[model samples]
Target: MQDVRVIPPYPEANEDGIREGKSKSSKFSFNFNLKPKEVKAHLDKYVIKQDDAKKTLAIAICDHYNHVAECIKREREQGDSKSDSDEEYTKQNVLLIGPTGVGKTYLIKTLAKLIGVPFVKADATKFSETGYVGGNVEDIIRDLVTEAEGNVDVAKYGMVFIDEIDKIASAANLIGKDVSGRGVQTGLL
Candidate 1:
C-alpha cells in the first residue's frame, strides 16, 4: 500500500472570521505523490479496454489531488492569513460520458480506494429539486461526510459519482416544466 501523509487540524477562522486558536474541526488533506502514469498503471491492472477514459481519468485525478496538496501547503505556510493567490486557482470538474457496462464507476472507485479517500455514488433520477419531494443534491455531500465517519474536513476531498445524469435532462417537447430534470441540474450546480 502507498503511504499517505495525513494533515492534522489547523487553526481555522471562527464565525466572526477570526483565527484565534486551533479549531476543533479537522480539515482532511494529504500528500498526493502519485504521477498520472502511476495511477493509470494501477487502473490497467483491474480495468480492461477504454484506454482513453483511463488516461483522461488518471490525469484528472493526479491534477486535482496535486492542486489540493498545494492548497493545503499554502494554507499551512500562510497560517491564518488569507492569500490572493487562491483566486487564481481554477477548479477542475470532470464529467464522464459513456455507454453502460463501461468501467466508469469501477475506475473511480478504484482510484478513490487507491488514494484512501471517501467515495459516494448516487442515481440522478432519484433526486428531485426540492428536498421534501425527493433526494437533495446536498445529500451527496452528507453521504460523503458519513463515509468519512462524520469528518467534514475529510469529506471535503471525497469523490461523488452521480450516475444516470442524462436521465435528468429536460426534454424539449415537454409541455410544462421538467421539475425532476432541470430542477435537479440546477440543484447540482
Candidate 2:
C-alpha cells in the first residue's frame, strides 16, 4: 500500500492575500526611461483635445523624473557617500490652475498611470489646519505612503493631485475670519 498527498489548486498567499511576500505596490516599476514625446503620445490615447496642456505637462514631468533617476544613479556610483560639497537639484513642483472640468486632474492621473507610479488625488477643501477635525496637508503625504504600501521611497516620487486648491483662499466678504481656509493655506506653505 502507498500513501499520497494532494496539493491545493489555488496558489498560497499571506494573510493579506498577497502572494510571495511581495507588496502589491511593488508590481508597478517606475519608467525612468520615458521621453517627453512618448509621454504626450500616451496621454493622447486617454485625453481628448488640449495639446498645449499635454505638451507642457509631459515635458515637465519627464524632466522631473529624469532628475530623480539621475540622482539615484549618481548616489550609487558614489557608493552612497556624500561629497564635501555637492549641489543637489530641487524637485520642481508644477501647479495646474484652471476652471473645473478642464482636465487638470485627468492630465496628472494619466501621466501617473503612464509612468507606472502610484497616484493619490485629494481635495484641498477637505483639509483643515492642524488640531482641527478635518485632515491636514501632511496627511497627503501619509496617503501617498499608504498607496505605496508603506514604501517611503516609492511614495516620495508618487504624484499627488490636490484639487480645488483655490478654495483655500480667504474670503473677502466674510464677516469673521476664515480659519480653515486661511489656516490650510498657511499649513501648505
User: TM-scores across all candidates?
Assistant: 0.79, 0.74
What TM-score does prediction 2 earn? 0.74
Q: How close to the true structure is residue 34 of candidate 1, measured as C-alpha lDDT?
A: 76
Judged by whole-model lDDT over C-alpha atoms, candidate 2 comes out at: 0.69
Q: CA lDDT, every prediction?
A: 0.74, 0.69
In Å, residue 5's CA in model 1 sits off its true spot by 14
Lowest lDDT sum, 10 consecutive residues, model 2, at: 1-10
Q: Write the per-residue lDDT of candidate 2 for residues 62-137, one digit (tens) a residue.
A: 7888876665566767765344333665556778877889898889987776655568999999998788788889
Which stretches in model 1 have alpha-carbon errors above 4 Å?
1-27, 80-88, 171-175
